[model samples]
Target: MMQPDTLTVFYDGGCPLCRREIATYRALKPQGVRWINVADARPAAGGGTGSACPLDRAALLARFHVQRPDGRMVSGARAFILLWHRVPRFRWLGRVAGTPPLPALLEGGYRLFLRLRPWIVRRAVRDKRAAPPG
Candidate 1:
């Protein structure tokens, strides 16, 4: 299997809300990351696709997940923190999140995000496929 340094962001490509954020991330940070859409995680692509392991689409869509080099899986706020820490400018947010209170705070915030996630998900599903980055 091919893996890159740092983090791999497995997101719901079908989610407009998610894709909008991904699009912003793509525009702002151009290094130190590989963004993988759950829809694109086909077995032929060497990424987890089917209901095996921790990479299936439905599972991934439920939350943000990051696969570390050591094969550890971090999800939700921790996953976002790992990812935010990698972005050039937003790395500080990750640092802050790693702090005791901040991660906890983010977790609380993540719960809220999930509470509102279904509404967000519906909006995202309504979004048209965006142009792939050049």
Candidate 2:
């Protein structure tokens, strides 16, 4: 069960970029935040005992999602904004980006990124495979 103050983040762990970003956030140890990896068969926090994700697996995996403390589920750039506000290092960026026009512009950019993500991920994988062992 999630507390009313808990913010839940739904992320796709299968994507390398997403995984790396999520790992960075986890390292930050934000307060009152729960990270759920939608790519897992049974996703949850603390060894699969957290509350179930609000959306179905497909919907959760489609884009970035953040369930605010108030229980509002936000996606895309708006979702990123909500997440940024929770992290001390990103709060300023969130405030600036959440401003009018910026949010819209950021959303457009996010949409484009989504469209190119598959190719980007494939290229990243290919590059990793071709890199010689350190």
Candidates in order have lDDT scores of 0.75, 0.84
- Badly placed stretches (over 4 Å) of model 2 are 41-52
Sliding window of 10 residues with minimal summed lDDT for model 2 = 43-52
TM-score of 1: 0.75
Candidate 1 residue runs with Cα over 4 Å from true position:
1-4, 43-53, 121-134
The digit string of per-residue lDDT tens for model 1 on 54-113 reads: 655666878888877666778899988888877767788888879998888888899899
Task: Pick the lDDT winner.
Answer: 2
Model 2 clash pairs are none
